[model samples]
Target: MFEIGDKIVYPMHGAGTIKAIEEKELAGQTQEYYVINMKIGDMQVMIPASKIVSSCIRPITDIRALKQLIHNFHHGESDEVLPWKQRYKVNSEKIKTGEIQDCAEVVRDLLRMNKEKTLNSSEKKMLDHAYKFLNSELESIKGITDNQIKSFS
Candidate 1:
């Protein structure tokens, strides 16, 4: 269970702060929902505790875990080039699943490609989204600004 002011990762939505906990009557029963305010935008979402796991609401990764992710992002790369359509399809799936590790994989793959040449609009947007998601979590855990994190990268 998350309390107000706690940071959580909402699949596809990235990192959000728990703004409030509220109870509402629905279907003749009272249920509680966590009100999450997105860090990157003016969006607020309500998630029921009963469905938290399925919704992929989870605590941010700890420092060690985050370091592992960074290491993987830095080291994991494929020399074989894949067709753009296939790469887009696979990366889209990873982004949709809202798994942090999967997002890291997408960032790593795109960064590798970028080193070789420019990316298409869609690929650039995906890379930006992944960077936003990871950077938010990194900022929260490291007590630094996203810009600072970007500077080091």
Candidate 2:
């Protein structure tokens, strides 16, 4: 279970530190929720404590894991032949998973595709969001820097 001061990643929204855990009443029911101070966007989110697992809220990946992810990103190949619509759908789902590796793949694949051909506006926006989400989490890692994050691209 997460507590105040624990750092976590909320899928699609980016990473944050748990600032508080409180019980609140809504719809005549009282439930515990985690108040996260998001690292990006300077925002806060109140996530239902019971839904933590289902929502894909997870701890920040360690530096070692992140290094491995970066290595995979550099070596992996994207499915460039997939139609844009199909590719969009797949990438969107990956971003929703809140997994660092999946998010990195979305950023890497979209970037590689953009280098070959221009991505339509929708894909361009997705790339921006994915890149920001991945970078925000990377920033939370102790020794990583924006330069290292950019090198993944």
Best by lDDT: 2
**Superposed Cα deviation of residue 7, candidate 1 (Å):** 1.4
lDDT (10s digit) by residue, model 2, range 24-105: 9999999999999997789999989999999989999888787788788999877667888999999999999999999999
Report, for every candidate in turn, its global Cα lDDT versus the true structure.
0.78, 0.90
Model 1: weakest 10-residue lDDT segment is 143-152
Model 1 lDDT at residue 6? 88
The residue-by-residue lDDT of candidate 1 on 58-91, one tens digit each, is 8876666765676676776653677888888888
Q: Which stretches of candidate 1 lie above 4 Å from their native place?
A: 26-29, 142-148
* Clashing residue pairs in candidate 2 (N, C-alpha, C atoms within 3 angstroms): none
Instruction: Tell me each candidate's TM-score.
Output: 0.84, 0.93
RMSD of 2: 1.4
For model 2, the stretches where C-alpha displacement exceeds 4 angstroms are: none
